[model samples]
Target: MPTLSESRSRLLVSEAGIPVSNWETADSTQEAVSLAKNLGFPVVVKLCGDEIAHKTERGLVRLNLKTEDAVEEAADELLSSVTADDGEVTLLVSEQIRGNRELIVGLVRDEQFGPCVMLGIGGILAEAVADVAFRLAPLSRSEASDLIDDLSMQSLLDSFRGEPAVDREALINVLCALGDLGSDQEVLSVDLNPLIVANGVPIAVDALVETVEG
Candidate 1:
């Protein structure tokens, strides 16, 4: 199997109507700093490359960088780290988003079910919680709604603290699109974690796609 890079994965999902954070790719610390400045302070910086996945685990991700100096330092460290491994690297700078709710959306192929869409609570404890629901591909609007309602922690979607309730229609759209993508034989799986909700809109922060090898 072949896997799409983070940037490529995000692009593929975005083309399918999923909302993703705005990002720019850079090849050097200086370029990363410039991109970060252009995107504004308190941005996210990560090493990006075809072979570099699980950036957080590799210490390639820098978050909430609030100063040019900080961005420069992070970019330098990330570039050095990734380059040492692959001999080359690209940096990705994105606008930092603030959200308390994290969710996961994905697709997988099953022997009996064929393509299936999955929804679950996400974040560091995603595996621990294991609260997820699934539906077959090409989900109808009603099926999409049921998928959300099926989650063990449905309260997460309701208005909590001061945050507004998650936009159900937008969430439904994302799932339905994923369902459509799942139906493609070329697509093997998709892992979209930390699909953060900000001001009621869900934005995909990180994603990975596994595709059938030629």
Candidate 2:
């Protein structure tokens, strides 16, 4: 299995090839805090180690904070809950993705396609309404564009009321990056749900990267 870090999960997804975002690694609480501080306000803090599936389910994640002190508190809560008596722990703090909208983009391994791409309206919105879309890997710009249009809440992209329009190019880039990760790397699952958006900008709030056993 390819480690998300060693695999350069974010690096693999690019605007040059498709579209992408930035990522940083955190091996310690201090490091994660530093990263969160550098990334600026409204970021996420997560426990980024192996042997775990859903951080939220385990109470191993925190969201929407503006201070290092708050991050430290959240990190402590996550670290304490996810660690075993005999195991070590590592944390990853990400830039808080702010926006009124939330969305999910991920990849699933397929027997033939290797990796299949997925999209959905995220956060509580996705929960309330089951708006999701999927497509095969190695998609053309046209294919991706169509996939976006096919979404049930596609009109949310337009600048609603006084809100700004979502940076569609950026959103498409994130989805394509997930597809690329599944294609070029050996991954079991790539889940970035509640990839929050505010004023049309998207940032992955919670992520789950796992390896599939063959």
Candidate 3:
């Protein structure tokens, strides 16, 4: 099995009608700084490579960089860190999104159940919370809605700390798309974690896709 790079994974998800944050890839600190200027301040710099997962754990992710100097420094560090390990690296410069609500949407193939879509409470503590739900692929709108309702932490979807309520319809569309992706046998699994809800809109901030060998 081969893992798709985060940028490629996000592109695939975006093509499936899921909203994603604006981002650019750069190979040098200068290019990264230029991209950050165009994307505006308070951007995130992450090392992008097929071999690089759990970027935060490897210090390959830098967040909330509010200035060009910070972007330059972080980009340089990320490039060096990943290059040291993989010999080549690309840096993803993305808009920094602020949100309190986070969710996970994924696809998996089960021997008995076949393809299934998953929804869960997401973020750094996602594993700990483990509030998740699953439904067969190719879900109907009603089934998607039911999946949302299945979350144990339903309150997170509501307006919290002054933020607007999550757009349930958008989330349904995401789940439905994941279902469609799962229906494709080539795709083994999909992971869209910390799908941040900002001002009621859900944007996938990070994504990964695993595929079977052809």
Candidate 4:
């Protein structure tokens, strides 16, 4: 299996009607700066390439950049950090999203069960919490709704602090979209982490897709 980079994976989800953070690809530091300015201050920059799959672990991601200089510096550092094995690296400038709630949605292939859709509590503590639910695909709107209800931490979906309650319809759409992908023969898996709830709508900030050669 081959893993798609963040930008490519994001495109896949976006095409499936999943909301994603605003972003653009940049081939140079100057281009990155220009894109960041257009996206507004407080953006994120990441080194992206087909072969650079584990960017965060490799220090290729920069977050909360508030100015042109910051974007430029981060873009330069990210580009410079690329290794020969990384292939053709580029910069991905994305809008910064903030929310108290983070959720995960994905598709996986189980040898015996075929395709399955997953939902869970996401972010850095995802592994520790491990609050997740799985359902066989392709899920109907009703099944997707039930899947969301399956999570043990239902309070996380409710209005918290000052943020509005998560829009359940939007989340259902996401799960259905993943289920749609799971039915595709070429798609091996899809991972959307930290689906930040902004203004009650879930938006994917990062994604990864694993695929098989057709």
Q: In candidate 3, where is summed lDDT lowest over 10 consecutive residues?
A: 80-89
Task: State the lDDT of candidate 2 residue by residue for 63-173, as single tens digits.
Answer: 776898888788777766765741444676666555677777777887876678888877755756878888998666667777788788877778865778878887777
Error of 3 at 47 (Å): 0.3
TM-score of each: 0.95, 0.76, 0.96, 0.97
Give the C-alpha miss distance for residue 38 in model 4, angstroms: 1.2
Residue-wise lDDT of candidate 3 within 30-105, one digit each (tens)?
9999999999989999998887767778877899999999998898777656555553468999999889888988
Candidate lDDT scores, in order, read: 0.88, 0.66, 0.88, 0.90
TM-score of 2: 0.76
Which residue pairs show collisions in model 3?
none
Ten-residue region with minimum lDDT total, candidate 4: 48-57
The alpha-carbon RMSD values of the candidates against the true structure, listed in the order shown, are: 1.4, 3.7, 1.3, 1.1
Q: Which scores greater on lDDT, model 3 or model 4?
A: 4
How many residue pairs of model 3 clash at the backbone?
Answer: 0
**Model 4 alpha-carbon drift over 4 Å, by segment:** none
lDDT, residue 155, candidate 4:
88
Candidate order, TM-score descending: 4, 3, 1, 2
At residue 66, give the lDDT of candidate 4.
Answer: 96
Q: 1 or 3, which is superior by TM-score?
A: 3
| lDDT digits (tens) for residues 84-140 of candidate 4 | 898877899999999988998889999999999999999889879999999999999
Residue-level lDDT tens digits of model 1 in 85-137: 55346788999988999999999999998999999998899989999999999
